[model samples]
Target chain A: MVEVKLFASLRTVAGEKGFLTDAASVGELLREAAERYGEDFAKRLQIATVLVNGKNIAHLRWKRTRLKDGDVVSLFPPLAGG
Target chain B: MIGGYMGKVLQVDLSTGAIESYSLPERMLELYVGNKGLGARLLYDLLPPMTDPLSEKNVFIVTTAPLTGAGAPSSNRFNITTKSPLTGAIVNSNCGGNFGVFLKRAGYDSLIITGKASKPVYLKINEEGVSIEDASELWGLDTEKIQEKLTAGTGKLVIGPAGENLVKYAAVFSQERAAGRGGVGAVMGSKNLKAVIAGGKKRVPVAHKDKFKDACRKWRQLSREHPATGEELPRFGTSIFVNKCNATHTLPTRNFLHGSYDEADAVSGETLAEKHLIKNIGCYGCPIACGRQVQLHGKNIKGPEYETVGLFGPNLMNADLKAIIELNYQADLLGMDTISLGNTLGFVMEAREKGLIKTDLAFGKIDRLSRTLDDIAYRRGLGDDMAEGVRFLSQKYGGEEFALHVKGMELASYEPRGAVGQGLGYAIGSRGGCHIAAGYPIYLEANGPITVDPLATTGKPGLVVLNQTTMEAVSTIGCCIFSVYMFLPKALLELNARSPLISKIVRSTFLYGGNIIGKALSWPAWTLPVPAPFFMLPQVQTHAHCTGERYTLGKMMELGKRVVSMDRIFNLREGLTGADDTLPKRLTDELQRAEEPRSKVTLSKMLPKYYNFRGWTPAGVPREKTLRTLQIEEEPMLPQTAMGAASTV
Candidate 1:
């Protein structure tokens, strides 16, 4: 099982902090999230950043990066402030 | 006269008790615009070189932009510009409050004050006239009480005991908002001025009313559609960055010794909204409503912003959110700047830990904070030293190595070790360790959604210039800095998320193409005269309509560059050389994490390139040609007697 976290507007759309997913890859996990949360969440997710274990996936293997059991994934929408 | 301008500047000489009003030169208005930009020009022209900031020689200006009181969203901002008592640099501190609106309504665009008052006094301005009234009774009052004591219908700018006592980081308060940085209030105290009240029924006119109205409507719509502005900011406020900054390791912890905090969530905006917030507040004409109104000690007060939370929270190793809230309120009531106040406390805590000073304050200790804040305002004992800010403390207490400041002013809450470009910004920022002045590169480096490598130093010079120029322009026009959030629209964010290839391209453009972009943009305004699309930034169109002047993106960017250059020239004349453009040893020499060898900021690698791109000499002075191209003239030295008057006062 993987723990997924949502932040800022992503959290607002998700209607909860996050959920547990059993998906094996980041792409699969995101797909599951989209299906469960509906279109608004999916649209927000489209602009959201995905981080695996505190590392931005863009620096890693994008969505193709594989995930393992007990891994934590966090999603954040574009945010700005001083 | 421009449609947005009141066409007059009020000049007051406290020493002589003389008040004069002069028409603003149309040429000067066209060249410098207003507020921060025009104020810089005025300060440069009026101030003698190296005048003591706390002395009567220092010129103090309160200025408004054309957009201010022109019915533009979040445009009711006024700027306080003067030589900083803390940093000895030119400081232009802007505040979002009703004072600017009412000041414009009272038939003036700016107020120029000079000389020391014979005694404590306050100035009251109305459609009828302006007067310098005795304020002896109002001298010791706190910010909240003084405004209430003043006439109800007028808008006020008041100082508290902190300013009266001349705390280096004392702030000028207007309503719940503050022009808080660089000890602007200390300058006011030096003048023995208590408050300035403005009230009138005059309306700010627009040049092309129909066009201006249409632009404003579209601008509001654009703001509403942007996710960052319309949703995230409105719902969560700026404190929402706590969790994100923590996750990104950009949250300053333990006086910037580390970047991550264990208890960040306790002070997060989510927690504030969920448990403490009574309602959301906003500045005049602001649609985002990003301000927080939270219940503290049975009273509803302005909640702590992100910087306050970080500095008072993780930076001091304290986790009590309640303590932070209360301290935030106490600091504001005392007319102290929370950013500087929190940083000072963090420095003292670290100083205590290292045996650099003998203080009872300890890291993570909460009980004495409220009393300590009071002590600072009154300049009592150790609080007196603390009131002098980190620069003085470091000099006297032998902790300069760990002093988390730049050029005298303390750093804001964003720890630069996690975002190295921000480190560069802090070091070279004109008004000391100001994040806004430094252009806030941490957004692109770490906190923003699509980011460059936080530890990378290669493309930062160019990126820093871009952000700095853009933000300077935005501030000059009296808009909230938050309005810049829409620069990266929802479509770009969506594209960044949807395609890794696109993200790579975007990130690469910033990381590698920064120099090319910066250099190209550094060209003369005539080379790029076209205005960017309204959707990209409605400010250009709104400005054009309001002033009935042709404004383009190039002109806007050029104005920003000129403003920055003008400030640099002023600082240079005041003896602030490139040598002073430096960060503390903590940021430069110490790595945040032991294992991450590249975690520290390598400022030397970026500063030279930044200067070159800015068309400045290697010593960081703007080149003659650069100034000429930007149409900035060398400010003439005004004689002492003529300081507060163009004609007479």
Candidate 2:
């Protein structure tokens, strides 16, 4: 099981702050999430930052990066400020 | 006057009650531009080196840029450059307030205030002349009250009790916004000046009226189109960075003992917008409207910015957003800088925890905070020590290692360990730990449209140099630095987010491009002649159109470089050295998380590279060749005695 946390506009789009899921990898978790949150959320996720264990997934293996039980995933829409 | 300037600068010398006007040399205007750069030049020339910041000798300058009142979006801002009692270094505080616009409208581009008044007084400037009015009734009033008591339909800048008591971080309020750092309000209060108000019917002259207007319209449209400035900022305000910074392990928590806070999301911009925000507000000509108006205690008041929220919330271990909101309002009304106030309180809390000092203040308990703020403002009890600022308090008590300040100014919300580039920024920032003066490099390192490796020290120096130069040039031209958010446009962000390979390429480009940009900055300004594309950097285009000057990206970069070097000279003159470019031991030696070995600011690795990139000596002093290249001299002219006066007060 993995804990998925959403922030910024992503939380509002997902209709929840977080959820517990049994997806085996980042791809599995996100594909399932896309189905649950809808096509609009799927589109939004294209522009959202996905972090696993506090590390940005872009530096990881992208969606191919694996997830494990107790691993935490956080998603944020692109943001900027001083 | 070419354009935008009122062609006169009022020099108000309270010691002799003389208000004189002088037309700044045209070469100086072209070289320094206006606002921060101009103010820096004026301060450097008018006040002797090593002058006491709180003494009658310190000079206070208020300067507006050409775009201040020229109907440009995000361009109506003013700057206050003065010697600061807090760091004893140069302080150039910029504010997105209407005072700059009104001052321009009142037929002056700048005001130079010097010396102390024998009694409490306020200065009024309008179409007819200037007056130093007795301000006994306005004295000791809160910022809001004093501003309210002022004449209506005019721009006002006022200080409250914190300033009057000489609290080191006291801020001056113009409307609800603040010129909010480095004891500017204390300088004002030291002069026994309660307020300064300006009003008039003068119109700002634009050299190319039609072109300037069109460029401004397009600039506003562009701001609305950019993802960061238009959508996210307008919707979330600055607090949106909370979740992003937390995810990146850059959020300051528990007085810098930790990075992420469990309660961070509770005080995030999303939470503020959902729970407390009444509406999004804008400053003067700002189209981004990142300011927030929130509901507090059945009344609506100015909401805390991200700095206030981060430092007061997670840094102090307080999850109560309502408390932060109330404290933010309280700090503003009391006319103290919330950034410094928050850091000071956090230091005290940790000191209390370690038994280093005895105080009622503690982390996660804010019950006494309101009264504590009052006490600090009034300089009563332990608040007297707190009024001396974190640097002084730590020196007097114990715990200097974790005091969380550089050169006396408190660090901003981004805990530097998680983003080491920002750590370098804080260390070498001209104004000593100021986020803006450090060029807001956290944007490039952590939460920008693109992200570079947070732990790498490879190209950070060059990146920091570019960011600082860009931010300085933006401020020099009188635009809100938020407009630079469009430098990373929507198309690039969407493309970056959509493709992992492209994102990698973009990040690598910035990472390595930093080195190239840094090297390029050392080359003669004339070597790069291309104007940045209008679509990409509309600010340069708008400035050229407004002022009818030939402005390219090269000139803008050069202007920024000149300002940076001038500040460095000013600091060096004030006895600051390369040794002063430092962060607290807590940030340098301690990791944000024990498990993350790379989560510490490696300042030593970046400092030499930064100095080299700026063409400065390894000691961080500007070389004589560089000074000559920038045309910064040892002296500039100031108006003489009474006859130079356009009118006397």
Candidate 3:
């Protein structure tokens, strides 16, 4: 199980700040979120920033980055300001 | 002479009641350009070393750039440059108020004000000319009240009670917008001036009118299409960074004791947009309209930026967005800077908890906050001391270890430990702890679409140099810094999204190319000709069109470098050494999290490299060769009035 958190436009689109899901990897977690939310969320998720436990997965394992039960996965879609 | 210039500068001396119109040199304009750069050069020429910021000898300059009123999007801005009472360093406070447009329209390129007024007075400038008017009644009024008392149909710059009372962190107000840092407002008050108003019917001429128009049109379109500038910013405003910063562990919480805040989302841009926003607003001629207008007690007012929210909210352990909004408005009305104000409060709250001072102020306590704001404005009780800013408070209260300042100015809202590069930036920043002046490297390290390893020292110094040069260059011509967001167009971000391999390549390129970019930046401007391939930076292009100059990438980078070098010399003359560029021990010695031993700002590791990239000695003085290359003469320049005629610039 992975804890997925959302912010900004993603939170608005999903209508929830975060939730728990049984996903073994970063790719599986995104698939679950995209499927649950719809095409709009999926399109955004493709380009959104993914951080596993405060570390960016882009420099990590990308979609293949494994997630443990306590792992916190945060998703942000092209955020601005500051 | 280039177009987009009024070509005359208004010089006023309140002591003798003398007003003169003069012109700046063409060489100076070409070298420094305008706004922050122009103002920095002007201050260096006009002021003596070690002059007291609040004394009659301290000079105040108001400068506008070519794009100021040339109908360029996000290009309407002005600068107020002076010595800072808070840090005793050079301060150039840029603002996006209507005053720049009005000042330019009134037929002047800049205003140089010196000496103290004989009495409480205000300045009025129009096509008729400039005059100092009696403002005995207007004195001591809040910012909103003073503006209302002034004549209508004019752009106004006024100070409130905090400024009048000589609070060190006082700010100048131009309508809802503020030149809100480094005690510029306090300097205005010291001169016994209350307000400066301008109105007229002059249009900024364009050298290449059609080309300039087309460039601006395309620039506007590109900005509109950028995800950060067009969508996220419009929807959430600057406070939108709350969540991102929090997630990245960059949010300043509990007096810089922690990096992340548990309740950051509650006071976030999203929350403000969802709960309190009345409408979206923007600065003059700005297309993004990133300013937030929210309802506070049934009256629509300006919203807080990320700085105000982070410092007032998470920094002080307060989570009430309504209270933060109220405090923000209150601070503005009082003519005080919310950044310094918030930091001072955080320090006091933490000091009280540590038994360093006896006060009712405590973290997460909101009841006394509003009254304390009033007290600070009026110089009453504990607020009086707090008004002096964090540096003074720490000195008196015996908490210098956790003072949370760089060279006496409080740090910005970003907790640099989360991004060591930002820490390096803050330490070496010319103005001391200002986020923008630090080149905002946090964007590349933590927030932007393509981020480097936040904790890695691998390529940070060269990267900081590249970023700082570009930022200072863009600022010189008067474009809003937000416009730089389009540097990463949506197309590239989309590519990064669809393809992981491309993302890796993009990240690596930015991370590794920094050193090469830094070296390339120092090349001669003539070497890099026009038509910089497919992606010409929108700013350099629009500037080239606005003024009939060959604004090449190298020339623009050189201008930015010269601006920084000019500041370096000024700071050196004013008694600040390279050693002065530093952060507090807490940020350097202690990690934000015990688990992350690498999370502290390793300034020593990057400072020498930064100096090397800057073409400065290890001690941080620009070499004679570097100065000559940049055309920065250490000797005080003869007045611009002596250099040329009204048609000069």
Candidate 4:
């Protein structure tokens, strides 16, 4: 099972904070998270930056980047001010 | 002897078309100091208790300090101070260019404008004299076109339709740079004024010229040596902070609902320099050429700053750098503040999300974004509502909870979710939600000697006050805040290298010289500490000591507090109560910590402590004793309170 944590405005759609999901690809994990939540979950998901464990997905293949069972994915939206 | 200042003030009344000149008062210069402080004092004195912002009675002032035009390093900035149509408080916005220098050379330290012009006109000041010229032909001309049409390469401060229409957040533009924020241009437009074109060949006289030269050398050297100032800012421009800020989760995106971005790399300064920048531009005598003349397609234009990049780019969910450049250009031409425009647009997008204003205004609709900008500036249909800015929009619609503004002014690029104290600063900031007005907790959150995790709430309120007060002084001096990154300590050092005359003055007056002279003069307790002449240092030797006055961290922090409290008092007199000073509900509640473990803003945990540190009442009104301590006159209109009553008074 993969653990994905949602933060900022994205958490509003994710319904809960972190959830355990059995998924193979990063795309699949997000899709499942959306299915379990609502359609707004997918639409609201664009704002967040995804991190596998502690490493950013930007270092890899972006959203298409694969995920593994027991892997941790953290999602955070952009913050503002000075 | 800071080099940038013209050491003069120009007062003009449009009602009779009369002009008056005055040498900046020595006491005022010593007490209130540069642009921001001088502005605070001038406006506070010149304006009455309940003056309407748009009335002929209001004064529109543009002020620069002694360090402004002086070949002083980074003294190439000036501020516009006026009553804001948006918030009806004191609003001062700074712009960097040759304008301040030109105005200074024209024999003015500041320009105080009152009354309304009978017709649309632009004020032209040359070596010959000042005249109010008909701007009927120049009206509606874009900033670049106006500059091109001017006879000489004079400094021109001009407004556009938005300002003319009194859009409230309209800005004044010159050479693509803007006196951004606080609707100064709107105030100017309300006065029926169009532009001010000024230039002069006269050299500004320096006090202790020899020591001034030495300070100039040192300041230049120090600026060149500093990593961010010398390298990053010069090479990549202010947009360089984009990637770094994103990495740290401080970048504002998606109407500040999110704190991270996907295509952050596309908008990074490094990317812009590599892809678009054609040449570097510098303001007056500044060594750091952070301004980039970017070439896109066949047109060359000033590139967007970090705030612009974040606002029009990722905040709208469009990461196209070229589009942002064009958007910035469009906004500039329209005389709209890019920050407020972007913020208002973001609010609209969020409204769309909440099923409020449905017109294809979604996250990544670039075409809609462009149309929306035009619509807002022109105040057409839904655009009219957006032009009122987010606060007005939220009120008109039904999402005050998600409205991303503090005091009507839209928040700047940096969002508060990642930096909690910044949120508090924005909430309590006197001039609505301004970052520079008091960028407190921000320094602590990002790059202070004492670092706090962005998510942390402790130590922020004190830090916020500290930032506000110090920034108040710096802006008052009319110097760029970037100097803080380079010469916070070295600016205070007093080793005389060259320029003997200036050296004596620096040693005798600036470098704790007041104490030495005061002791010698038998006035032990009355020695005044002069701000270090950071801008006046010789370019080559400035690295040995950064220019501008530098003080111990404690002293600097105290200055920040002083400015913050003074501004608070001004707001209190203006009828701002604690109820009006607060953060949006989402930031205080819905926005969660991403970096810090289980941390939220926890504003309730910080406000009381901040109030105590400020010596204000629990309700956040500045106490009469605090006002007395600051030497502020008691406001007669303050409601009388019954002893031990509910304290509603």
**Candidate 3 segments exceeding 4 Å error:** B530-536, B635-649
* TM-score, every prediction: 0.97, 0.97, 0.97, 0.78
Q: Candidate 3 falls in which docking quality class?
A: medium
Cα lDDT tens digits for candidate 3, B259-297: 999999899998999999889999888988889998888
Measured against the true two-chain complex, the DockQ scores of the candidates, in the order shown, are 0.65, 0.62, 0.72, 0.02
- Please say which candidate is ahead in lDDT: 1 or 4: 1
Tens digit of per-residue lDDT, candidate 1, span B388-486: 999999999988988888889889989899999999999888998999999999888888887988899989999999999988988898888998887
TM-score of 3: 0.97
The CA lDDT of each predicted structure is: 0.88, 0.88, 0.87, 0.68
Give the distance in Å from residue B409's predicted Cα in candidate 1 to where it truly belongs. Answer: 0.9
Candidate 1 clashes between residue pairs 3 or more apart in a chain or in different chains: none
> What's the true lDDT of residue B475 in model 4?
61
- The 10-residue segment with the lowest total lDDT in model 1 chain B: B640-649
TM-score of chain B of 4: 0.86
Better of 1 and 4 by TM-score: 1
Q: Give the Å shift of residue B248 in candidate 4.
A: 2.2
| Model 3 clashing residue pairs (backbone) | none
The complex in candidate 2 yields a DockQ of 0.62
Instruction: Report how far off residue B421 is in candidate 3 (Å).
Output: 0.6
